[model samples]
Target: MTTQKIAVLGPGSWGTALSQVLNDNGHEIRLWGHMQAQIDEINNNHTNSHYFKDIVLDEKIEATTDLKEALDGVDAVLFVVPTKVTRLVAKQVAETLDHKVVVMHASKGLEPETHERLSTILEEEIPADLRSEIVVVSGPSHAEETIVRDLTLITAASKDEETAKYVQGLFSNHYFRLYTNKDIIGVETAGALKNIIAVGAGALHGLGYGDNAKAAIIARGLAEITRLGVKMGANPLTYSGLSGVGDLIVTGTSIHSRNWRAGDALGRGEKLEDIEANMGMVIEGISTTKVAYELAQELNVYMPITQAIYSVIYEGKDIKEAILSTMTGQLKTEDEF
Candidate 1:
C-alpha cells in the first residue's frame, strides 16, 4: 500500500522479472548484478538482452553493481541468485546490512554441499540482529511469462504467518497474485524438488513418450516428493498446494524451463557437459537431482523417478534405458501420503 524501496539481488531472468513486478507495484527498485555490462545495459538502455532477449525494462528500475548500494535505505531484499551462489550473495548482503530488513528468496534448489534449503543457508549467513522476517517465494510461475504481465499466481511462505502475509503484499497485483503459506519447509522442499521431476518430464518428451508417460511421471514424482518432504519434517498436505503440484505442472510442461530443456537435450543424446554449455543458464534440476537422490537415500525414502533421473544425469546411464528399467520394474501398491 505504501511506496517502498526494495533491493533485488540478481539480474537473471527471474530476478529481473520480479523486479518489474515490484516496480509495477509502485516500489522504487535497486536491481543488482555482478556483471558490469548487464548493470550498465539495464541502467542505460532499459533492457537485459542476455536474459530477456526482447523485453524492455522500466527506466525507473535503478541498476547497481554494489551490494551495499543496493541495500542502502531499502525496506526489503529479494534474493534470486543461483543455488550454487546463494550463500555467497547472502553473505554479501549480511555484511552490507546495518538495519533490519525483510528477506525473501525465489531460488529453488538445495545446496548440494550441505543439502540445506536456501532459507536455512540464509539463516546461517545473515545476522539475526540485522535481518527481519525470512520468506520464500515460489510456485508454478516462470519469469518469461511473468515479465510480459501474463496472469501468474505464486505463494509467499514463511514460518511466521505475518512474514508470509507481508511478502504477499510485497508483490501482489492484478496480473501477479500471491497467496500466503505457513509451511516454509513444505513450500521450499516442493519448490526445489519439482525441478527434478520436470527434468524427467522433458526427458520423456524428448524420448518420444506421450502424455500418458508425462502424466505418470508427474503423479509418481509428487508421491516421491511428498515422501521425502514428510520425512524432512514437512506437512504431507503441502505437497498438494501451489508450491507443489502447481509448480510441477508449469516447470514440467513448459518449454521455458531450463531444467526441462536440459533434460530434453539429454534425451536427444547430447552430453551433459554439452547440454549445460549451450543452455547459457543454470539447469537447476541437474544439480537438484543429485541433492534429491542423496537426500532420498539418507532419509530412506523411496524415489524411483528421482533415482532414474539421477542415474542418467550423474552416473553416465542411458536415459532411455533408465526410463525403460523404471517402467518394467516390479510394481508396488501405491499409498497416498
Candidate 2:
C-alpha cells in the first residue's frame, strides 16, 4: 500500500493510540493537539506521558499545534476529539483545508444542543467541497489496551462504500483489524448509546450488584439501543455487528472505560462535578445519556434502561430508586423491539 500523510486531530488517549497504529502501517502521522507541552513530549521524547505513562510512540508520528500545519496536503484527516468540541475543531479544519481529503471521526456522542450525531456535526461544520463523505470509526476498542498494541477490532462505516473501505485499509494492521460497514446510522448510534449502558453497568457494579445484574443491563440495554436506532432509520441487523453489541460488551464490562468509571463513582454517591473533575477526561456517556434520553422521548421509543440512567445522572434521582422504578415498571415481552 502507498504511504499517506494522515492528520490525526486530538492527542488524547484514543488519538495517540490511533496515531501509533497509523505509524505502524508506515504512514506519516501528523498528530494535532492544543497543548504545547504534550506536543513537545511527543516530538522530543517520542512519548505522551500524560496519557500513556509507560508507552513510547514512534518517532515518525510528528505532533503539532498548528491546525494548518497538520492539515497541510494530508491524504486523510481522522478526528478523535471530544464530542463537545467536535464542531469547533471541524470549523477550524474547514478554514485550514484547501484540498479535498477523506474525513473520518472516532468520536462517539451526540450533540447535547442539537442531539445530532458527531458525523452530522462534522458534515455541517466542514463543507462538502473540502472533504469526502464522513466516515465513522467505532467499535469495542479502548485506548488503554490499544496503546499497548493489544489486538483490536472495530468498524469503519460510511454511506459511501469506497470511503469506508479506504478507512478500513488505512488503519488495519496485524494487531488491529477493521471491518467495513455501510450502515453509518446504526454504527454511530450504537457507538454513542452504548456509553450510557456502560455507565449503568458501572453503577450496578458500584452498588454491589453481581454479574447477573450487569449481564441483564447489557442485554436489555442493547435492546433499548436497537429500538431507538431502528426508530431513527438504522438497520436492525447492524445492532448485531461489531459497532453494536460488540462495543456495548466491551464498554460495559471493561475497567478501562471512563464512562463506566464515572458511573461507578456516581453509584457510590459521588457528585457529578466531582466525578468529572477526578476522571480528568470527558466521560462521553454522561452527556450521551442526556442526549439519548431526549432522543428516545422525541422518537417515542421504549428505553427504560436509558431512562433510569438518565434519571440518576440528570434528574438527581437516587441510584437505587432509579433502578427499582425501572425494575417495577409495567411488564413487557423479551422481544418487544
Candidate 3:
C-alpha cells in the first residue's frame, strides 16, 4: 500500500477512530479539532478520554487546533465533524487548499436550514474545481466498536465510480471493510433517515417495551423513510442495501448511538435541552428530525414514524403517548407507499 498523508477534521470519537484506522494503515494523519484542550490531550496523552476512554491513539496521528497546519500537505481529507458544522469546516479547508484533493465526509444529516445533505452543503461551501471528488462514508458501524477495530462494514458512495473505489481503498482494512456504491443520494438519505428511527427505537427501550414492539418500529420506520427516499429520487432498492436497513439496525439498537441515547432520555421524561447538555456530543437525529419532517411535508411524502419522532422531540409530546398513537393510529397496507 502506498503511504499517504491524510488530515481528519474533528477529534470526536468518529474522527479520532477513523484517524487511528488510517494511521494503522501506514498513512500519516493530522487529526484536527477546534478545541485546544482536546488536541493537547491527543498529542500529549495519546488518548481522548472524553470520546474514546481507555483507547490509546497512534502517535503518528498528529493532533492540531490549526486547520491550515493540518491541511498543509495532505493528499486527502476526511471531514468527520458534526453535520451542523460540516459546511463551516469545509469552507475553511477549501480556502486553505492549493491543489485538488479527495474530500470525503462521514457526517450524516441534512442541513437544518436548507434541508441539504452534507454532500450538497459541501458543494455549496467548497468550490467545485478545488475538490477532486466529493464522497460520503456511511454504514451501521459505531465509533466505540470501531476504535477497538471490531469487524465493521460500510459503504463509500459518489457519483464517480472510480472516486468511490479510491475512498474504499483508503479505509478498508482486515477489520474495517468498505463497499463502493454509486447511489450517493440513496446512501446519504438512508444514513440520515435511519437516525430518526433509531431515536424511536431508543424511546421504545426507555419506555420499557419489549422485542416485538421494537421490531415493529424498525420495520415500519424503514417503510416510511424509503417512501420519502424514493420521492427524493433515490433508487428504491438501495433501501434494502447496507446503507439503509443495515444502518437502521445498528443505530436503533446500540447504546453508542447518540440519537438513541437522546431518545432514551426523552422516553424517561427528560427535556431536550437537558439531554443535549448531558450528551456533550451533537445528536444528529434531533436536527435531522426537523429537516426530515419539513421535507416530508414539502415533498408530500407519507412519513408517519418520522412525524411521531418529530412530535416527541419538538412538539413536547409524551414519549409513551407518541409511540402509542404512532403504533395505533394508522392501519394501511404494509407496503402502501
RMSD of each: 1.0, 0.8, 1.0
lDDT tens digits, residue span 166-238, model 3: 8888899999999998889999999999999988888888888889978998898899889999888899888
- Pairs in steric clash, model 3: none
Model 1: CA > 4 A from native: none
The residue-by-residue lDDT of candidate 2 on 1-337, one tens digit each, is 7999999999999999999999999999999999999899999999988778899888888999999999998999999999999999999999999999999999899999799998999899999999999999999999999998999999999999999999999999999999999889999999999999999999998899999999999999999999999999899999998999999999999899999998888888889999999888899998998999999889899999999988887888889999999899999899986
Q: Which pairs of residues collide in model 2?
A: none
Candidate 2, residue 57: Cα displacement in angstroms equals: 0.7
Order of quality (lDDT): 2, 1, 3
Stretch of 10 with least lDDT, candidate 2: 49-58
What is the TM-score of each predicted model, taking all chains together? Answer: 0.98, 0.99, 0.98
> Global CA lDDT of candidate 3, please?
0.88
The local distance difference test score of each candidate is: 0.92, 0.93, 0.88
Best by lDDT: 2
* 131: Cα error in model 2, Å: 0.7
Candidate 2 structure lDDT: 0.93
How badly does each model clash, as a count of residue pairs? 0, 0, 0
